[model samples]
Target: MLHDAMWDDEFPHDPTICYLNHAAVAPWPKRAADAVSAFARENIHQGARDYPRWIQLEHRLRGQLQSLLNAPGKGDIALVKNTSEALSLVAMGLDWTEGDEVLISDQEFPSNRIPWQALEGRGVTVRQVNLDASDPEAALIAAMGPATRLLSISSVQYASGLRMDLERLGRACRERNILFCVDAIQSLGALPFDVQAIDCDFAMADGHKWLLGPEGLGVFYCRREARDRLKLTQFGWHMVEAMGDYDREDWTPASTARRFEPGSPNTLAQHALSASLELLLEVGIQRIQEALQQRTAYLLQSISSIPGARILSPSAPERRAGIVTFTISGCPNAWLFQQLKDGGIVCAERGGGIRWSPHFYTSQQVLDNALAILRNALQHYNRSR
Candidate 1:
């Protein structure tokens, strides 16, 4: 396992800021920035002269993503503009009957919820299941009726950090012949995700959050057997089998997940993402998960020790990921958020509370500094009250 010191050079964040916002936009590592810089310089010196090498990097990125998700093959992966685009492809591509139902959690990010809800125009009903029950997975499975065609859910709840029992849900979906789609934006780089182990038909995640890459590129994994189920919703030269044969009058979409990419590739973003994935792969996902859990555990324990802190996120080690959200009694969330922002403690205001998300590389000093700021702010608020 790599220690914090070993990875210090990779992340040289501003010393003054306590960055706990990996759940939102993450700061790219030094290697990723260097990759982008080098690419930019090459483009300036020789435009398209080294385009073949850039394509090779793109291929390598697909292989890295294949390893990250543990998909059956590299061909199962599609590099989309972002998670929303990928979800849109799945949502718009699938044929929906009048009575078909799509099951999802009530706590999903808008990206996960809106796509299925959009299908309502096609006579498809979107059912949102509350995940506050003792057995969230069981509740979701029970809600599935004969009309249920798909179960679209996030691997981890964005606001509450409630990690789902994907294996259990996937098994139930398989038994019921229901399609399973995972919006993994919050959990992909923070945790170890396996599409094969979960048996999900489709999964998507953006690179900006935990992947430590640029904003425009994300990944979509479509199971080989389930690929043909979704009718093609977009088309262009890049998505065709004979992509380089522009002169060919006849063409067919690529049999692989590449069929979803309708336009030209984002090669610049691809270079940066490929470099970021290299760092994650080098450290190993299992190690990253361990480090991230340690950080969350510390935050949970420390926040609970505060006089009025009420943690909104799950307390159980197995039921959480990198997010820790909480609210202080008698303190307005907006006020508290502003205080943290002023104190250089980077976080997000979410789920009616303040959310602090720390990555594996987040140092003890940053955590302590953020906590100190919170304590001082609470004391000041108490005095004013």
Candidate 2:
């Protein structure tokens, strides 16, 4: 089926919009959309009479997430509301001392920073390390002190699109006995990720962005050995060992990472995300990475030729991922963003410039059209000024 002539059927984006913002929310694939519709129809008419089937679907999704992260097993994966919730579980779950410190990069999205920052009242200091150096991992390592209890970093900086060397940082944390956590929302579906290879204690990603799924559902992976280290902050029937035994007087959290989930599952989102993940798995992450690399390279080359355009993202291929950010010298970022929006070029204003994030299936025609729009916008800006 993947070898079909019109494989792009999976992503039937509207012709009017040249979408280059996969780093932000993404349009769901046709299969995912179909899955959601079917699930809704089933709910409306059947009222979950086939509820056992839904559970099976959820089980499959856990397995898919497990395979995507190269996690030890499905037992290590938890379905969460979003990346923020997963980070919160880690932030509030850990038993922090008054002087304990959490290290993170200064460029992190608020999802990675705010939760740690919230611990300030508890005398937990959130240290933000500068990642602008030639060796960001080394800078993070140098910032670690005796009080540093955990290092939570993004696999890719949301705005700058700077890809971090998780293996290096993970090794450093291992040697220092610091817990390593990764906010992997940007890299999970765009690049190949291995929980084992990175050796992170916790990792989480939302399904809406690179995963090409709906919002409100995300995956959280916890290393099995570290699961018991963090205290459970929430409790519900679903999180208990005997989940269906509601009348039981004695209960304990499940031994698996599912202990983090404290309420009913998002079964509707499960149908959508499962289909999207299956599509990704069928295509394979390596192919997706290669296609995105080509798109990034093409955008970089084309943008460099435009007068006054300065690429803010890293020039080295290995240092970047799906995102390519740049600025036109004379044009205000807001003005340029408006111009692109008016021209039906769907990009974003980020990292002090305009950011373009194309996915694996983004066509060459869309890139050509968006670049043309950018050139026209720059020309108009220069002329008016």
Candidate 3:
């Protein structure tokens, strides 16, 4: 277990604000910030003199991602621009027939939805299953018809904070002979995620959210057996097996997930993400999940205690991740969101309510302060009404 001092040292957020927005862009840990600063200094002074070392750091980042996903090998991982790009790779690369279909939940973020919807041009159908039922996985599985070529869903719904039973869905997909894809942005760093356990053919997530890294860099995991299912959509020197062999007349894509990356690596983001992942690995993901569950439980209980506050996110522990969304009766979401923002409570208006997504390291005092502000605002609004 990491000490309290270590948590405090890693996250030195502004003392004045209560940051409960990890579901959105998160503030980088001090180590990640320091790493980017050092990288910038190196580029300013030495300029590619340490290019080899930078590549080494990138390799380390891949290995860390492999560990994070429990991927079969580092070869199974590709560092992409973000989750949308990764999803697009799969959506466009797959060989879709006129009537082939892609299945997804209605609650998916745009990153997971638009790519498949874009496939309509290719005569591919995109079906959205409502996940508000008592058994979401069962609903999804039952919705997969014979033409369903893939099941692409988020591990946790963004607005509702509803965690899916990935393993069950994977089993269903396997039985139906349909490909499984997961948008893991909501669950990757907030909860324990295993691609192997889920048996997903493809999975993707951005570093800026739960991973505590910057924008413009993310991970794409392609299962070893399913790698060849998606045809190559992009090609470049960096993706060739004989990389740097400029004189070679014939070239083949690298026989790994690197085939998905056809451009120069984001070395700067690599260093920052690597540093952030190092902190997560050191503290351990299971511990982080436990801490986040505690925080979510606290938020759920505290928010429910406030008069007229109605929970929008799933209340059951097994059904939720880091998000706790709620609304106060008779209080407009926009106005409530502004009140919280004005009160130094950093949250989001989502799913007809305000969403509070606290990280594992978020202090109890921060949660208390945010809830207090919320309570006061609701009470004042109720009195006026």
lDDT of each: 0.93, 0.92, 0.92
lDDT of 2 at 263: 94
Provide C-alpha RMSD values for all models, in order: 1.1, 1.7, 1.3
TM-score of each: 0.99, 0.98, 0.98
Segments of candidate 2 deviating more than 4 angstroms: 1-5
lDDT of 2 by residue, 290-384 (tens): 88888898999999998888998887878889999999887789988999999998888998999999998898888989988888888787788
Which model scores highest in TM-score? 1
The number of the candidate with the highest lDDT is 1
User: Candidate 1 lDDT, tens digit per residue, 51-145?
Assistant: 88988888999999999999989999999999998898899989889999999999999999899889999999999999999899999999999
Q: What ranges in model 1 sit over 4 Å off?
A: 1-3
Write candidate 3's Cα lDDT for 1-385 as tens digits: 2236667988876868999999999999999999999999999999999898988898899999999999999999999999999999999888889999999999989999999999999899999999989999989999999999999999999998999999999999999999999999999888999999999999999999999999999999999898888899888988888887899999998998998999899999999999999999988999999898899998899889877879999988899999999988888999999989999998898888899999989998888899888888887777888
Worst 10 residues of 1 by lDDT: 1-10
